[model samples]
Target: MASEILSTTDCETIVKNYLNRNDFEVMWYNLKPFFSEVNGFLGEHLLLLIDVKIKERTTTLRFFTKRFPFEHPMQSQYLNSMQGWQREIYFFETFLPNLERTLPGYSLDFVPRYLLGKPNDIIVFEDLTLRNFDLPRKPSLNLLDNQHICLAIKALAKYHAGSLAYEEYKSRELGKPYRLYSGEEELIKEPLIRKEEGFLGYDWFKAGVSGLRALINRVYKGEKPLEEVNAKFEILVEKALQLMFPHSNFRNVLAHGDLWAKNIMYQYEGDSSEPINVLLVDFQLQRYNVPIHDVLLFISLTTNRETKQKYFTFYLNYYYKEICNQLQSLNVSPEEVSMAYDEFLGSVTFIMPEIKIQGALQRLQQCGNKDFYTKLLGNKEEFIKFVFGDKTPFALELFDTDDNFRGLLTEAVEEVIESCLYPEIFREDCYRILEDTLGKSAYELKQYKTETIDEKEFLFKLEITVVIEKNEKEFKFLVQNKPLGFAKVIKKL
Candidate 1:
């Protein structure tokens, strides 16, 4: 509803201070707040969908805002040029009360309860938009259902078993809150993806993911400084010695890190042949990395094993049978449940195109192959010799010669190489771990063979460098041409 900078007597004194001590009240004629506009990059996230009554226990109060981190300005310069997404709602209210006191079969079945915010920029909660939960106004991933694959494999083994029981029983009460492709939230998502660049919309093809990226500036002119991607993610937390729990526990736990089935939510138990009550709302990107990077970015960008291989082989055998029934409900054996499903199928990454966005795959080749998205967007003879700004003036007759838009331009470059989802299982294990550790100089890491998110492990114009020098006593590693352990470093100096 356009945008109302809070009011209705400040939404009736923030819904009468959470309904004056609680039997629930707020109804303001089915309150609504759903907008993907204001040139979108997510702002006005005071989370609402209100309509509550209680006493009759007609529950619903998902008034989330946990918001208090503002300093704004954005609508796209590529995408999310940050402004602390309410610091991921204060890292899901300081990691959901330590994941509801460590998973009793974890259940957050649909956001509708979490409120507290006001000191300018309000906060509220629980409002599943007054239910009757519809979904199919363009739903995909074969509209999942086997009780939404047993509540998304019981919410991905109760979120990697409450991040393996909060990093094996509370490590400094769980830390490392989301976003990390080398942090400061990738310098505020990179100046709003360069101010929403070639802009792509039309509900950007919903979670069926036809969206794209690769807008490039050598991925914004040679990145190797946020103090070297946080000193190579702080050298994968000092070569996995211990205590660094969330770099997405590839060995077990932590990695909701933004999985996409459009951040899932479902209820349909009665009408849809029962049992699809799986619910998960965005935990503002819970990171660490690899639970197969949220199961192949939520089964290759939202859903299609040609359109549901039984909700992707029943949520990949419901996380290899709930990490073998949580190591037989923690009696633990069978070699620690086959080493936690072989580190959960070596945290699956054949390439990495989860739900599409390399500048929405070169703006769909700058709108249907304007010559390979103007040669992966370096710009083709001034995007086909100057026509400027929003790129049209018959966008070169959309690649003419009597066009039909040439077979949807080879079906949008075979779905932008199936959204980089299989570039031959990440061209031999993430290009031999990025040229055996960030070698081949300071930029130029290929293997992006597309069809969609480079079938999972990705690369292109990857400029990286790590020149170290010690002397008489310790450190020593010289000469760079290419191929070496990409700075996953931690020198302590």
Candidate 2:
């Protein structure tokens, strides 16, 4: 079936369309699988290395081809549900072209140049490897240096800024407001964060959370801080689902929802360790959300704790400044198009907990590679099922024995406790919510307690002394709390 899809005739058609001419003859061509099993989970990738002749000259061109892996019957249904093929087709054919036209003279080089696409099936891109852009040298694909981080942030900022510019351009041209996925079409209406079934659906997400909890429990067993964090897994899962979807309160941009190290390619100059250009790939999880969604995900997953502690503020400020520069280049005011630094920082703080949880889960999922799983579990299909089917024994085993995995998982829980749970901003937000709900000006948190109902549920009881005008009133409430703050006041006591 894949061969049929990329037959000689089909390849010629793709090439002709890309070159804008039918006069060329296909002299020679070769197709080789691209990426390893670890990186090729969603699609069947083929490097279409070809040589063609036209007007007495032979030209070589490399195109990266990706098609829905229908051959893997087990993953086909799941992949289809993700709508990656459809979304990527839309991005290459519709979204990028619009952006290119709108932001003329602005560099839209962060993404690979689109060549051709087949709706719901296959797409083609100019292979960036041929352009000297390659994945980071780190075997784990983590960006260790500040220069790499800076380049990534710059590219991301430009991409977000370009999306805003396109929206403004469309709004002016059509004499109305415009945004990505604003239309009622089925392709755009499909959500990546599906509650029922899909790659990032409730089932898969719960499985990840379950795996992380089991791993933490087994490895850290009676440790109090980790135990507390583990207790919040249920709440974190729900909170993550809520935070991942688009929120209306913040300034939104078309985010490359998956921005981890693997999806990014960098170009280097001579023998220098620093990169000159950063190119982003994989647009399947692209969504219209606040820019911080992508930024937080990238920083959390790609860098370790020390890098984050030393350079987190630097990265944030650099990204924000780049966004402003990009907006100004497009003749749009940064203040009008972007969130203020404080508000942006608040959004980051609000979403950090969910992001950390997601980073851990993503790493857990990545552990289900063919080499690792097959060697340990013997059956790849069964291993995959266990990884995504709300089973965790295999993942727990990996976490227990694998030093790198243990380190990453341990760090995630540590971050969740140190950076997410105990932050002053988090506490302030909790108190602020209580104040708003009770119509009080201020609240002194007298007692804050967490009750674990079962393995999958939690309740937060807050006893606060409310300052009503000049008087202090004591009250109790059963608060449905998220990591960000109190979700709601369930009842008053």
Candidate 3:
């Protein structure tokens, strides 16, 4: 019914514009819904398959059209608030054209060819599926094998390199440094970072943090209380928020902010299962950030633990090398355009904890059974409330029953603890055999009360009380500490 609004003449005009030929007459045309409802949350998609006749010749044309979700006012409002539609339109219209011109022979095979775009209304692209490019046969969690992962990484490398090259060209032409989010162009400004009044506001982020906190509290309840870990998690949240902004000291490039399996398509060799090419779609969340931001997200969301462990270093090396090669091809020095391998590794290690949290939340939503949650709670909002609110019993039950869910959540927690939180204490030689020797020790945070010791001086004392269970029975030891320490706070102006 929605497709009825576009007449045959309209379709003919679109096809004519794309082909740059007015002689072709429309013979047949059909528009159908494209992907699933979950795939395009902020927009509607239509697959347009048309047959055109030119003189005595007949040819088929396939196009994918994405339009604003006008039917869903709330979603439209959200998109407008975040400039999602505008950013995507800029990508297809201005950004791609400039990139192609800057690096004239460089390969943009990873990007789908943009056909036409109407600002905040619709964008049409050559349907990549017609060229044998398709989504991986399985869901994101299980879809990408090592080959797919490598290809995706390589594609990302090229994309980042291309953007950097374009920036260099624009800077030279303008006689000044040119950055995408230079605060001059509203359309290219950063969208989601520190934005507190939209769908992805602080409340949404807090909800995700609350959900993770609940899971941590539930999982490590008895002897292994996570007071220190929880404290670190709060700090990590702040750090993660800061990381969303671009670091001036680091190598910043245009990153596909949402690079997951669903956003990628692979063109396989004829008949064989080997993929020879990759195409990245969806630029709504594109932003200027460190290269590792995209790399960490893609690897974390798409691959399993074993795949990551086995090929993590190889993938990193491959991406770095590819991007360096891409830079070299574009006449830019890799040393100047890209971060060194050791620096890249440091960036990866530093940012991985927050990425783990992001991966956990995204994977949970992707892999979760929405119908089951909605049916259980009467609606999707209620289900979100259940997770974000104090409903740890249900969470614990889900954790116990669902292997995939449990694995994803626990992996995030374990990674944070092992990599980010109290690494010095945990990694020490003295604690090497503590877990094996003590079996498991549980502790509860009885009191974590803070008092202002000197209001004028901005000095505070934190008192922590813990109850630890020693033996198998209820042999609890109440350790009520005095003041843990005096923290001096400097008020920032």
lDDT, candidates in the order shown: 0.39, 0.68, 0.66
After TM-score superposition, what is the CA distance of residue 353 in candidate 2 from its true location, in Å? 3.2
Model 3: weakest 10-residue lDDT segment is: 424-433
1-493: candidate 2 lDDT, tens digit per residue: 4466666777787788778899988887777788754346678788887788999999987889887777666556666666777778887788777788778777667888777777667788888776678877665765357777788899999999998888777778899877775545445443545566544455677777777767656655333576566556556666667776556566677788888887888887655556788889988877777788788788877877656644565677789899888888898876665466656665676676667777777777653434675564456567467656765776767666777776776766554443333333233344445645655433344323333322233355555554455677676666554433334556776
Model 3 quality (TM-score): 0.77
Q: Write the per-residue lDDT of candidate 1 for residues 91-171, one digit (tens) a residue.
A: 456555666665455444434455454432545554444453434223333234345545565667655655555444443
Off by over 4 Å in 3: 2-13, 35-38, 56-60, 139-143, 174-176, 193-201, 221-224, 270-272, 370-400, 423-493
Q: Which ten residues in a row have the lowest lDDT in candidate 2?
A: 446-455
TM-score of each: 0.28, 0.79, 0.77
Best by lDDT: 2
Instruction: Note the clash tally of each candidate.
Output: 90, 0, 4
User: Tens digits of per-residue lDDT for model 3 on 113-159?
Assistant: 87666667777788887788887755544447888888899989899
